[model samples]
Target: MALTYTLDNARSLIAVALIIFISWLLSENKKRFPFFLTIGAIAVQAGLVLLLFAIPNSQAVLSGVTAAVDGLADASDRGAQFVFGYLGGGQSPFATVPEGGQLPFIFGFRVLPLILVISGLSALLWHWNILKWITRLFGLLFEKTMGLGGASALAVAANIFMGMVESPIVIRAYLDRLSRSEIFLMMVVGLATVAGSTMVAYAVILGPVLPNAAGHVLVASIISAPAGILLARIMIPEERKATELDYEVTLKYENSMDAITRGVQDGVMVAVNVAAFIIVFVAFVGIVNNLLGLAPPLNGEPVTLQSLFGYVFAPVAYIIGIPWEEAHAGGNILGVKLFLTEFIAYIDLGNIPADAMSERTRMILTYAICGFANVASVGIMTGGMTVLMPERRSEILNLAWKALIPGFMATLMTAAIVAALPAQLFGG
Candidate 1:
């Protein structure tokens, strides 16, 4: 039994390592021996795992992040109550809606409003130059630590708050001049991590399901950054000359009201797109599953698409340390996230039985699936990048498929780390 367990874990690690190596080899431009690059990638991947275990107070980081996210939720709820009064359904506001006085449409409503509130607040912070300063600090760190160019570093730093495409606009002037490797890195990082704008909505969705989930999500993004960079480099070695040290922090808003107005518009578009995509995709999935369900069964039971995904990805889930019994259940969530949207996967996760997944498995899955790396995201990247730099549209289109592999691998690397660590490290 002990030997079998050891072999299972070893196989899991070897599988992940091979995936990373193959991704690097296929993506690399320079056919030279990738000895150092592979080592560095492994080191960065292993470092994140060790940091979580070695640090004595790692849970403190998760705890602080949870408190901050909870505080944001509370503040948003308070503001919603103030603006909409009882109609907003804020803090027991629903009970007082006058016995028979038409209850407000509540489904798919409470959580989305938080997006608008967060958008407004984020704009206010940007307008006040607070966000710019923070971005600069992170940008400087990345530049110094990872040896990235000014524009690439800024885009990476800005990615923590803004979307992948939106972050590049920070250094829009340099997009034309950025090397192919840098461009790929930016896109991979974007797919591997979440933006702050949508973090609140994700928090609201996952917080109730997974304890300290909000913090874990945040940490996942941060830890994934280094891995993203390393993987990008391994795949496409920097062929062009690197940019020099020219860090300029500036908020290019026309004015405060414009910033707020633009932010609101962006937020509304995102919300509508999210709602529309979920409706269409979920319906499509249901249709496929229904059709499959009608087919002849092999095991005296009707087989469906969900079951296929569950079985196909079950091994992957197990490798990530989910229990044998619940591996398929967890894999189904991941498979859904990759095919559809993370938002949809998250909603499904929230609905899953608490007993279905162990706490560590849940946390690792949360980190793994927290990205915009679905099939649809490729379209988004191509469109957004073309708009930013039309000259590179061909390159962006050509590289989109290649980018997905590393993007997926980046998140998997994060999950591998979470899985390899002891449960106590993440406060599970």
Candidate 2:
């Protein structure tokens, strides 16, 4: 394929300007806007996208990571199969079926188990100081360029690999004294990116629709770190910079076994929460759609929850480079991501007919909703932060609600920047 740009790609550049302008308008102190800093943040995201997609060497590295993740997923499947037998993709015990016939892959049995394995593996890596060094490097970058304090920068960087609540633990000693801007930035980064362990499940969900799903998912989380910082600073510009610098990782495990054991325990809670959310939220949407169905049909189709969201977010989808004809469908997924979760949204994207939307459209949407920004996360972030800093509960609550705007827009900023590039660069 050849490198090319369409009208939509140029339009996405305009959308990037609009997104930044909108963030500026919402700034707590508009006069304090950091113009050059904003430019630097945008440049960082653009540079990363080009390096990962447009450069052959970087793309090769990304493919290697994707291949390793795929192997990890396969290993997780084998463990699940041993536990759940045929329900988990193991060979069927019955001989009545035709030779070489395959069994259905159960999400709970097959995909959910990857979280446990990845979570344990991530803990093991952290125990080995691998993740710590990588996080420290990114933290230094954020501290220098974004002007965030060492603790805040470290927490934000760790959010790429850790959960919203879990990342804050690394900076627990400074949580009580963290400036409002630092706290807000941590919340924004946490919500703007997904955990590394959960990335496996998301990549698996999107694998059929996107080539190298793991690579894209990984890139999305990594790049969004800077985007979140940029938006957070814009919305809540700090009057003074933080002085206390503590860059060391505070989270510790007694040993490798302890890390794996505790990590798996945490993963169980996450896996169960995901399973429950899917069931309850899908039912809620279904019930609401049925209620809407009794009222009237719109444009020769029954009015459903998704259609309502599609109508509301279609313009946003179009502004981000999805063609107008396909924007409504893309908007629907984006809406689902906002209200429900990215996990559900990715599943919906995968369920769409493969030919219904162009590959570029799918890739755009994939990058767009690849975050933890949603209604549910506001409460999660707030609750988690409150536990870490109970004395500042009121402050935490105030910032948590406000963090949602920048947090949500951060991922959209990433998608808009990606949309500005040639779709062929992403293998679309």
Q: What are the lDDT figures for the candidates, one per model? A: 0.73, 0.86
lDDT of 1 by residue, 1-428 (tens): 01123443454575567666676567656465456655655565567556754577766776677788888877766666677654455444344665555355342465566777677667767777898788778777667667788788788877777777678777876777888888988988888877776776787777767887777777677667766777777788787777543545334767889888877776776677677778888998989988897888846767876677788888878776667788888788888888888888888787777776677677778877877778877777788899988988899988887877777777777787666655655555
TM-score of 1: 0.87
Q: Of the candidates shown, which would achieve the greatest TM-score relative to the real structure?
A: 2
- The positional error of residue 251 in candidate 1, measured at the CA in angstroms, is 4.9
Alpha-carbon shift of residue 302 in model 2 (angstroms): 1.1
lDDT: worst 10-residue window of model 1: 1-10
Candidates' TM-scores?
0.87, 0.96
Per-model root-mean-square deviation over C-alphas:
4.1, 1.7
lDDT of 2 by residue, 222-334 (tens): 88889899888888887776846555537888999999998898788778877888888889999998899997789888999999899999999999889999989989999
Clashing pairs in 1: 27-235
Off by over 4 Å in 1: 1-12, 28-30, 33-58, 78-107, 249-251, 298-301
